[model samples]
Target: MVNVEVIATEELGDRSYLAHDGSVAVAVDPQRDIDRVEALLSALGLTLELVVETHIHNDYVTGGRQLATRTGARYVVNAEDPVAFDRVPVRAGDEIAVGAMTVRVVATPGHTFTHLSYVISDGDPAAAPAVFTGGSLLYGSVGRTDLVDPARTDELTRAQYHSVRHLAESLPGETAVYPTHGFGSFCSAAPTTGGPSGTIADERARNDAVLEPDEDAFVARLVAGLTAYPAYYAHMAPVNLRGPAPVDLSPLPVLDPAELAARIDAGEWVVDLRDRTAYAAQHLTGSVGIGLGPQFATWLGWVIPWDTPLTLIGESAEQVADAQRQLVRIGIDRPRGRATGTIDALADGRPTRSYPTATFDELRTARGEDPVIVDVRRDDEYAVAHIRGALHIPLPELADRLHELPDRRLWVHCQSAYRASIGASLLDRAGFDVVLVADEFPHAQELGLTD
Candidate 1:
C-alpha cells in the first residue's frame, strides 16, 4: 500500500503532502521551510525522488525547487508555466514511473491558468488511486477564482466549474482526494466542510461543482463571495515565478532593552510575540501584540508596512524563533532584532500600555456611553450580522484607514476575539483608548447585540 502523510500548516489553512511506498518518496506543495520536509524524510529513511508543485502558490513560498536542489531529486512543474527556473516540465497525459507506482498528470486549471493535479496509483488497476488536487478541487468548495486577476475572474470561475466536474467524472469513486488548499485558507471560494481526509465519491455526492448542474449559478455565488486575502499574497506569485531563494532561518540579533525602546521610538515595528491576553494586560507602550500562533503571520503581513525594519519582543527566545518560522513562509526573511524576557524588563523605565477585555454583555452596558464599537471581521461577516451601530473596519484594511475612525474609546471586535486582539493592538499603538472584546461574535447574537 502507498503511504500518504499530510503536513498541515493550519495557520495558513494549507497542506503539503509526502507520499512513499515505504522506501522512496515524493512531496507535493512543500512550504518554504524545507527543514520540516527534510526532517520527515530523514526520519522515515526514505529517498527523496521528486518534489512537485501543482502550481505557483499564492500563499506560502514553494520549497519544491529548493528541496529538489538539496536532495538531487527532479523538480516537477507544469510545462506551460512561465517560470524562470529549470525543471522537468510536465503536461496533461504524461505519466511518471516511481518505483512500483505511477503518477499521472492531469490539467486542472481555474485556480490558475496552468494548474495541474497528480493522480498516484499502484500497479493494480482495480486498486483505488490518490489524487492531489492543489487548488482546483477542494473538499466541499473550489479554489477562489479571483486571485489571478479581476478581469479573468469570470473566465476562470467558469473553467473552475468544468475542471471540478471533470475530476469527479474521470476519477473513480474511492480515489482519495488530497487538496493543498481549502482547509481554512482564504483561497477557498467559501469555507470548506470536511475533516482531514475525503474521497472523490464523497465530493461527487456533496461538492457544489458536481451538484449544481448549471455552471453559471456556481460562478455567481463564487464571484460574489470572494473576500480579501492577505496583502502578502500580491508578492507571492511574483517571487514564486522567479524561483524564491532558500529561506534564512538564522537567529536574529538580541536587542538590549534600550535598543528595543529606541526601535519603537524610531517608528519601526516593535511586535510583541506574547499571547494576546497577556499583551493586552501590560505591554511596552508602542509594541503591537500579534500573539504567536497560526494566525500571526497572516495578520502581521496584512497590517504592517511591507519591508519595514521590525523588532520582536517575546517572553522568551523560543517565542521569537517560532514567529521567525511563520514569517518566512510568507517571505519575511529576517527580523531586524529581538528582545526576550518579561514585558517589564524589556520595557525598563518606559511607561506600559493596557486595554480592558470585555464580552458582548459588557459591551452592551458600555454602549450607553456612546463609545465607538468597531467590527474588524470581513465584509461578508459584518454584512451577515453585526452590532447595530458598530463601525466596520475589516482587519486587513484597519492600518490604512485608521483616520476614518473617530477619536473615542473604541470597543473592537471580530467574529472571534482573535482578530479583535490584533485590531485592538493596532489601535492601541496609534494612541487610541481601545478595549479588546474577548468574546465570540455569536454571543452578540445570543445577547441581541447584533443587528
Candidate 2:
C-alpha cells in the first residue's frame, strides 16, 4: 500500500510530500529541511526515487537538487528549464510511475511560465486522484502572477485561468488538492490557512479566487494583491537555476571578542541568529542582526553581502548548526566562526544595547506625538494600504539604508512582531531609540489608523 506523508517546514512555511510504497519514496518540493525527509525515509526503511518541483521558486532556494545529490535520486521538473543533477524532464500528460502509483503532470503556467501540477493516481479508476498544485493554487488564494515576465502577464493570466478550470473539470470531484505554500507566505495573493492537503470540493466552495469565472476580472483581482518580490529573488533565482554549488560543512572555531572585533574592523559582518526579541535585548556593536527564525536563510542571503565572511551569534550550539546549515543551503560558504562567550562578550566593554517595544495601543497613543512609524513589510504590502504617515523600508533593505530613518524616536512594525523586533534591534544598536509595535498595523480603513 502506498502512503503519502506531508512534511511541513515551519522555517519556510513550505510543505513537501513524501510518498512511500513500503519500499521506494518520492519527495516533492524539498526545501532546506532535508534532515526531516531523511529521518522519515530512515524510519520507513525506504530509499528515495525522485525529487519533484513544480517550478523554479522565487521565494526560497530549493533543496531538490541537493537532496538528489545526497540520496542518488533523480530530480524532476518541467522540461522548459534545464536543472542540475540527474533529472527526468516532464510536461503535460507525462506520467511518472512509482510502484503501483502514478503522478501525471498538468501544466499550470501563471505563477511562473513553466509551473506544473502533478495528479497522483493509484491506478484504480474507482479511487479519486490527488493533485500536487504547487504555487498554482492555495487554500484561500491563488499564486501571484507578477513575478514572471510583465509582458506575459495577460498571456500568463489566461493560462492560469484555463489551468484552474482544467483542475476543476478534468479531475474527479473527490480528488484531493495539495499545495506548497500556505498562510504567512508572500507568494500568494492572500494568506492561506488550512491543511497542507485539501479536497478540490473544499477549495471549489471556499477559495475566493477559484469562485470567480470571468478571466479578465480574475486576472485583475490577482494582480491587485501581488506583493513586491523579496530583493533576494533577483539573485536567488539565477543561483538556483544554475544550481547551488556544494558546500563544506566543517565546523568553525568560536571567536573571542578580540577576534570578532578584528573581523568587524576589517569589514566582515556579524549575524545574530537569535529571535528578534532576544537580539533586540542585547547585541554586539556594529553587528547587522538577522534572526534565525523562519525566512532566516532567505533574508540573511539577501541583506548581507554574499562575498563577506559571516560571524554568527547563535542562542545555542544547535542554533549555531542551524544557522550554518541555512547559510549553506543558499550556497553561502564563508562561515568565519561563532561568537565566543556570546552574552558575556557583548557585556565586556563592547557598547552593548537594547531596543524598546510598544503594544498596539501604545503605538496608537504615540501616533500624534510626532514619532516616525516605519513599516518594514515589503513595498507591495505597504502600497496595497498602510499607516498614512509610515515610511516603507523593507526589512532586507533596513541594514543598508539606516541613514534614511530620521534621527528621532522611531516606531517600527511588520505583519507581526518578529520583523519589527529585528529592525528595532538593528536601529537601536546604531544609536537610535526605537520602539517595536507588537501587533499588526493599520491596513487602510480595515485597521483604524486615521492618521
Candidate 3:
C-alpha cells in the first residue's frame, strides 16, 4: 500500500505530496524550501527516488532540483518543456517503478501547455490509482488558462474542458485526486468547493469544469472571469525555466538608520511588516505598510517594481523573517537589509507619518462634505455591491492609476480592514491625506453606506 503525506503550504494555498511505499518515495511540486521535505523523508525512513513537477510553475519557485541534488534523486519534468536545466524528460505512457508502486505519467494540459498528471497504483494494475493533477484538475474548478498568454486563453480553456473530462473517463471512480493548486491559490478558475483533495468520482459529480455540458460556454465563462494575478507571476515562469537557486534562510543584515533613510530617499522600497494599526501609529516616512498577512506578498508583488531594491522594517526579527519567507515564495529575494525594532527610527531626525483608522459609522456620519472615497477591492467585488459613488480601483492597479485619483484627502476601503489599511498607507506615503475605513465591508450595506 502507498502512504501519501501531504505538505500544504498554507500561505501559498498550494499542496505538495510525498508518496512512499515502505522503501522508496517521490516528491511532487515542492516549494523553494526543502527542509520540510527533508524532515518528512527522515521521519518516514524512505530513500528518495524521484522529484517531479507537473509543469513550469508561475506561482512560486519549485524545490525539485534542489531536493534532487540533496537526495541524489532523479528529477523529472515534461519532455516538451523548454527548461534550460537538465532533467529526466517524461511523457505519457512512461512508467516509473518505485518499490511496490508504479507511477504512470499522463498528459493533462490546459493549466499550462506541457502539464502532466501522475497516476500511481500499488503494483497491481487493477488497484484504485491515486492521481496527482498538478494545476490541471483542481478541487471544484480547473486552473486558470490566461496565465500563459492572453491571446491563447480561448484555446487553452477549450483544452482545459477536454482535460477534466479525460481524467474522469480515464481513471476509475475510486481514484484519489491530489492536485497542486486550489485551497486559496489565485491560479484557480473559481473558489474551490471543499478540501484540498477528493475522489475522482466526487469531482466528476461536483466540479463545474466536469459537469458543464457545453464546452464553448465553459470556455467563455472561464475566460471572462479570470481575475488579476500578481505582477511577480510573469517572473516565475522564466526563473523556473532557468532553474531557481537553492533557498537561503540565513539571517539578513540589519540596515543602519542612515542607510535606510538613503534607500528610502532614493525611492527604494522599505516595507513595514507590522500590523496596520501599529504602522498607522508611527512609521518612518516613505516606507510603505504591507502588513504581514496572507495577501501580503500579493499586494507587495502587485505594487512594487520587480527590480526595485527592497528593505524590510519589522517590529521584531521573527516578523522580518516571516515577511521575507512570503516574499521569496513569489521570487522577491536579495532584499538589501532588514531593520528590526523600527520604532527607534522615529527618533533618527527623519520624518514619521500616521493616519486615522475609522469605522464605517464614522465615515457615514461625515460622508457628504469630506474627502473622496476609494474602493480598492477587486472589480467583481465592486460590481456585486459597493458604496454607491465610491471610486473603484483594485489594489493591484492602484500604483499605475495613482495619477487618476484626485489630489485631495482620500478615504480608502477594501472588503475588510486589512487591504484598506495597506491602501491607506500607500496613499499616505504618496503625499495624500488618507483615512482608513478599517471596518468590515458587509456592515457598510447594513449601515446603508452602499445605498
Candidate 2: Cα lDDT at 6? 84
For candidate 1, lDDT tens digit of each residue in 332-363?
98899988888788878889989999989999
In candidate 1, which residue pairs get closer than 3 Å at backbone N, Cα or C atoms, i.e. clash? none
Q: How do the residues 303-369 of candidate 3 rate in per-residue lDDT, one tens digit apiece? A: 8888899998887889888887887778887688988865665338767889888888888887777
Q: Note the Cα lDDT for every prediction shown.
A: 0.90, 0.75, 0.87
TM-score, structure 3 vs. true: 0.97
Candidate 2, residue 109: how far the Cα is off, in Å: 1.4
Please give the RMSD of candidate 2 to the true structure.
3.2
What are the per-residue Cα lDDT tens digits for candidate 2 across 1-451? 2477888766556678887667887888877547778898998898898788988887767778878989998788789976654478888989888767887889988778899998877777888778888888777567777666777877777777777777877777688787887745666767775655577887777776568877788878776666665555665567778876655566778777788778766768887777666666677766766777667876676666667777887777678887777666565665878864566554467776677667767776776787798888887667667777888899878879988988888988888777777677667757788887767654323447744
- What's the TM-score of every candidate structure? 0.97, 0.87, 0.97
Q: Distance (Å) between predicted and true CA of 237, model 3?
A: 0.6
Worst 10 residues of 2 by lDDT: 442-451
